[model samples]
Target: MWMNEKIKASEVELTGLNGEDIGIVPTREALAMARKLKVDLVCTSLMSSPPPCRLVAAADAKKEAQAAKAKSSDRVVKVKEIRLTPNIEEHDLDTKKQQAARILQAGNAVMLVVRVQGKEGAAAKVLLEDLVRELKEWGRAKTGIQVSGKQAAVQIDPVA
Candidate 1:
């Protein structure tokens, strides 16, 4: 993120004000060019032998960063967790299903976790699979039932 005179490279790979490549030039020359164009000589890449720098206005750079941040924020995907027991009653299962439906409709995924102990392990797997089937209209199972020693889990993603 070196800017202007702070750029220590003897020669930098420069880009012009309108983003055209200006090839490699001495740091001093690049700084002079930036001053002539009334823009910042911003070092964009440091990994190369000659660091790459771009000419950009401070306001334009700030705006570009803000736009990228907003774009990334807009893509944030949320996953809601719903916990259940192997022996969940019918009414409770319906309520949990409804909650998952709401979360899916809101563009979020749902993770169903069914806790079990010993003999209840198989039941937990079945419960997870059954719930996935019932939720097919709202979301599809992104992952099949994964049964660990004491629990089974599945992720349901919203239908696109």
Candidate 2:
């Protein structure tokens, strides 16, 4: 997004202040026009052959870009991780469950991982299954509890 004197293209496909296409014009000419209108010469698309440039107020363009970025960020789904131990106490489990519920309500996936030692491996799997059942109203298990060696994990996605 080159602006003003930073635009390197010798020619540009110009769009006027009112969004009217001004066809391809020399870069210097476009800059002159923008200067006359008291707007910045913004190079909108650098991939095109002539590079598309537009005449717009710098502040307005900045606000539009920020708005677009914010809108895009809102749709991004993140995976929230909650780690637990097989011998976790009842109170601690409840705390983790509440945390997971909050993450699910925010439209994110929660991955519950339980680490165990030797004989506690089986307990870890059972613990994850019970947790999933308790959180069923807020989120559904995306995958059944997966147990491998000393770890058990399950992914829960927000109920849509």
Model-by-model lDDT, in order?
Answer: 0.89, 0.91
Candidate 2 residue runs with Cα over 4 Å from true position? 1-74
TM-score for each model:
0.57, 0.56
Q: What tens digits encode model 2's per-residue C-alpha lDDT throughout 27-66?
A: 9999999889889898877888899989999788788778
How much does candidate 1 score in TM-score?
Answer: 0.57
Worst 10 residues of 1 by lDDT: 68-77
Winning model by lDDT: 2
Highest TM-score: which candidate? 1
Residue 35 Cα positional deviation in candidate 1, in Å, after optimal superposition: 26
The superposed Cα distance between candidate 2 and the true structure at residue 66, in angstroms, equals 22
